[model samples]
Target: MRVAALDDDVEELDLIKSTLRAIGHDCHVFTEGAALQRELRRETFDLLIFDWHLPDTTRPEIVQWVRNHLQARIPILFVTNRRQERDLVEGLAAGADDFMMKPIRVGELAARAIGNLLGNALKFSREGAWITCAVEALGVDWPVRVEDEGPGIDEALQAQLFEPCVRGRSGTQVDGAGLGLAFVRTVAQRHGGKVLLDSAPGRGSAFRLVLAQAPDAPPPERGQGEAPA
Candidate 1:
């Protein structure tokens, strides 16, 4: 795939380009927003990797420009240090396809790009398929569960479900890069958490990411109304 990466940090730009290149992707690196915008006007790309903060502009502004001016549907993958719920919501609202925090993991970045593409594909093909996500307190642990009503995994494939490049039998007909689950597992483990899966053929799947919470943490405050989309 041809990818365009934009970041102000030289080291980060080099790392991103090198990583993408190692995986056989042709990457064009940019250190400023204006240069990227100019390139976008003259060239097309399969994917875009961006950092939230740049020397001249912010991610939201660039995202807005892409959405409103360029009017392109190219998948965007954000690689940045802004790791907050509101920040994520803002990025998604501004039309980014995926977001990853700083200290990039090349393998996970590839997997995320694949996951975003696969998710869009699934949305179009799977009738009545939907996802349910929730965050719940499990004693001193908080488990985030993402349940999908798509075709479930077969029993034989359950054992290595989280292994890299191991896609379930149900996904054979679906196009994917087969690294989504593995990346999920990696993120969970890195946070001193564990990933749990429950599924059977014809039964939907549920993945619970159990992360530790501080013992004395206060309960979450209820909001007044629905937040912005």
Candidate 2:
């Protein structure tokens, strides 16, 4: 498989590249997130490995860009030294398939999963239609919503929409395995939360993923910083 590994540490990048090469895979290394973003515009890779903190951009910003711009369901992994549980949650919520702590292990890079909610909205919506994603605190739960102006899902299809391999009529027009919603459901459940869908024919669709805030998590300040995306 072709892989792209991004990290500011030259030694770490070399280690990842050599390990991947030893496993008979091609690896492209980048020192800066912007450089990787530029390469992604013209090149395609089977997997992407990112460091949580980058010099030019953040993991979430770049990950969101990849999901929205590339529209590819490529798996992404984060290999970083940020070991906080909240860090892992934030990383996965940012659309990464997996998160790993550094002190790189040779065999630890093998895992796969993907979050394609934004990509699906982009694919199913009409050209120039509006798509908005928002994150807000609702009591002890954080609700992340992605709303799009597209052909609304039918009530009958919504019943089984999150089931693996199930798709709506409009889904037939798109190219996917119908596992996106299922993956979302899995992630939500694993986080002690649930995913909800609200839609009807012609009224568009809204997906809400509500995650429970950790008991030790600090409460959000009223107007201090921007809400996490």
Candidate 3:
């Protein structure tokens, strides 16, 4: 998962970055809230981890910006020393999905971050997180296939997978505009090709994009008396 972590303490931020990296997550750390906000405008993250008392901004302000201005559904997890009942309630009210106390355990942090992104395959992927892409001859055409070992899309959702703005019920909590498959379909159709999905629940998914191969170019003409080189 791609994650953004905000903390003013340099040591804490480094620990967060190293810990997340060890668990196969990419982390972008920021020392100030403004820098984090600036990055938020330019990129998308699967999760956001913020310290409650940032130097330039408060937790409430950042949460409001994410919920109101950005209007993003990206899950947020807060890390702070605020252990009071009121503090927890206020953070939750500000749109944080979960919170952790200071002096975090690396294992627990990794688990929580993964859980927020997706549930099972994301957190405990036994395949060790890999995607395979290949192009193979299919009759006179070539089919490019991308396969992932993540949880498969539901059979019912597969029918509308390429439709714009349509998201599977299982992925409604995921952060996306649901245009990826739609764009893929458009590109495949433009190339006199089609897209296919072969998947079943818990069996993973493979997306095949088949495109007709261009006809072979005619052999170059040679003079009648030309000698072989």
Clash statistics: count for each candidate? 0, 0, 0
Q: Would you list the rank order by lDDT, best first?
A: 2, 1, 3
Clashing pairs in 1: none
Encode model 2's per-residue lDDT on 136-161: one tens digit a residue: 77789867677777788989899999
Model 2 bad stretches (over 4 Å)? 1-115, 169-172, 219-229
Between prediction 1 and prediction 3, which has the larger TM-score?
1
lDDT of 1 by residue, 146-206 (tens): 5666667788888887765565456547544455666566555655677787876666676
Once fitted onto the true fold, the runs of candidate 1 whose alpha carbons sit more than 4 angstroms away are: 105-229
TM-score of each: 0.52, 0.48, 0.50
Clashing pairs in 3: none
**Candidates 2 and 3 compared by lDDT, better number:** 2
Task: Single out the weakest 10-residue window by summed lDDT for candidate 1.
Answer: 220-229
- Stretch of 10 with least lDDT, candidate 2: 106-115
Q: How accurate is candidate 1 locally (lDDT)?
A: 0.68
Highest TM-score model number: 1
C-alpha-based local distance difference test score of model 3: 0.67
